[model samples]
Target: MDEETFNISMRKFLKKVGVTSQQEIEKAIRAGLANGRLKGDEKLPAKMVLTIGGVDLTFAV
Candidate 1:
């Protein structure tokens, strides 16, 4: 595989994931607040799981 091509693709994928995830999270937070499910000062727990072929990783954010 070409290293430059692989790096570019990986960066694009990560950027898309980051932007979309942020938008969804913001929308969820707004909905929760509107419905009295979440207050404005709560520490929220978030997790992310990534799987690629035989590799799996989990991260807590």
Candidate 2:
């Protein structure tokens, strides 16, 4: 694939990993919500990643 194609493919792969799509990320940002940028919608056990301060932030919420 070309450079552009590779970049797009990589972006999709990352999104599949953690729902890391541009729109969703942007929505989260606009809502002033940020827990862990790495953790996506439902790729893993959400509860496994405990809170650092005092917030039970789910992957979607």
Candidate 3:
């Protein structure tokens, strides 16, 4: 495996995930606020799960 190629691919994937996830979260929050389901100043519990081959990881944010 070419380390440079793998690293570049991984970075691209992560960037796409980050950008799309942020957009989705923002849209959801906006909808929730509009519907009176979420207060503007609330701590929201969020979790992210990543699965790849034999690796499975969960992160709480």
Q: What residue runs in model 2 are displaced by over 4 Å at the alpha carbon?
A: 20-61
Question: Candidates ranked by TM-score, best first?
Answer: 3, 1, 2
Clashing pairs in 1: none
- Tens-digit lDDT track for model 1 on 1-61? 9999999999999999899999999999999999999989999988876656556654544
TM-score of each model, paired residue for residue: 0.83, 0.30, 0.84
Off by over 4 Å in 3: 54-61
Prediction-by-prediction clash tally:
0, 1, 0
Of 1 and 2, the candidate ranking higher by TM-score: 1
**Distance from true location, Cα of 4 in model 1, Å:** 0.5
* lDDT, candidates in the order shown: 0.88, 0.55, 0.88
Candidate 3 accuracy as TM-score: 0.84
Model 2: per-residue Cα lDDT at residue 22: 51
Worst 10 residues of 3 by lDDT: 52-61
